[model samples]
Target: MQEAAHTGVSEKSTIAPRKVLRHSVRGQILDALRAALVDGELAPGEIYSGPALGERFGVSATPVREAMQQLALEGAVECLPNRGFRVLTRTPRALAELAEVRALLEVPVMLRLARTLPASVWDSLRPAAAATADAAVVGDLPGYADADRAFHRAVLSLAGNEQLLQVAEDLHRRSQWPLPGAPRVRRADLVADAAEHVALLEALVAGDLAVVESLVREHFAGAAV
Candidate 1:
């Protein structure tokens, strides 16, 4: 039998037990592969081999295969006959339609959360927003994408509606298609986005639902461009 390599554990071990670790490994592979596909790191129509992906992610083929199936189910990739998975191509019109759907779903959620949730609920969002701003400033597209998603998720989570939150998250995943092959980060866009976030924070603090809705719409519209 092959012996598993043992690494020294840290003093503060937040690592989950074996079963949880296996689940997390699968999730990590899924998310990483999805991000790569959406960000255009893996170009549309590009074929990917499970074994190669597993090697790249430093995991076994089983997890990579699982992740690919998940991506396929999400419409990010497709299983090809006698080949491997291929990234799905998205049209500009499709992306525009997706943006519209996201705006419709998310703006209302943000408004409701702003009106209902306490300021303390937004404490977690501040750091994520700040990180996004920093990433945008530095032209770190991958980091910015992660932080951007986190910021939106934080706001959606505060709404306390599980169905809405899931829908919003799905919309967000779909929206990532437009970003692939786009410029890393535009300074002017970042500045404008940061300013909008500040204004949003202020609106939340003041418990202004109307302003929050308007700002959310504006933010999503700006991102569409």
Candidate 2:
């Protein structure tokens, strides 16, 4: 009976680790899929098979399918029965709408922060702001996306509202999605956007609310376009 008990305990221990490993693999695959989507490697409106993606990633199809399901839930893809996941074609109008909503949600908060947060606070954000510019210079879409979001999160976190930060981040991600049948994002565009980050930071540091508001509105308008 003791031997049986020991065997059962070992089995339970093994099961939990296996579950964790699967979850880890799924998370890794999901991140890769998101990177692919942002990089324009997975073209919009193109259907990608789990088996094929698995081959590319050197894994089995199960994790790829799981990751694709998550993307589907995020409205990034659509599942086709007996087929695979199709990357959704994002329209400019959809992007504009998302940008409009994001501006509404974030501009007021940013303006408030500009009024309240001191120069030291804005100065402290320079490194994160610079990271976005660095990534943009190299045309690293995935790097830029991560850095851009991180910079925004750093600025917004000053408001101390976790819920608002999360919502704004989601909107920001949606805005960055590659448009249908479009080539990769222009290096010029990324540079221009990255410049706005620097401009906004400077405006905030100088306590110039008018410049801040203008920059913020122009930033979102550029994002929408």
Question: Taking the tens digit of each residue's C-alpha lDDT, what string does model 1 give over 59-78?
Answer: 78678788888888888888
TM-score of each: 0.78, 0.86
Superposed by TM-score, candidate 1 places the C-alpha of residue 92 at a distance from the truth, in angstroms, of: 1.1
lDDT of 1: 0.69
- lDDT tens readout by residue for model 2, 75-190: 89898866677889998799889988988999899988898889999999999989989998998888899899999899899999999988988888878788877777888888
Off by over 4 Å in 2: 1-23
- Write down the worst ten-residue block by lDDT for model 1: 1-10
Model 2 residue 121 CA deviation in Å: 1.1
Clashes (backbone N, CA, C under 3 Å), per candidate, total: 0, 0
Instruction: Return the TM-score for candidate 1, rounded to 2 decimals.
Output: 0.78
Best by TM-score: 2
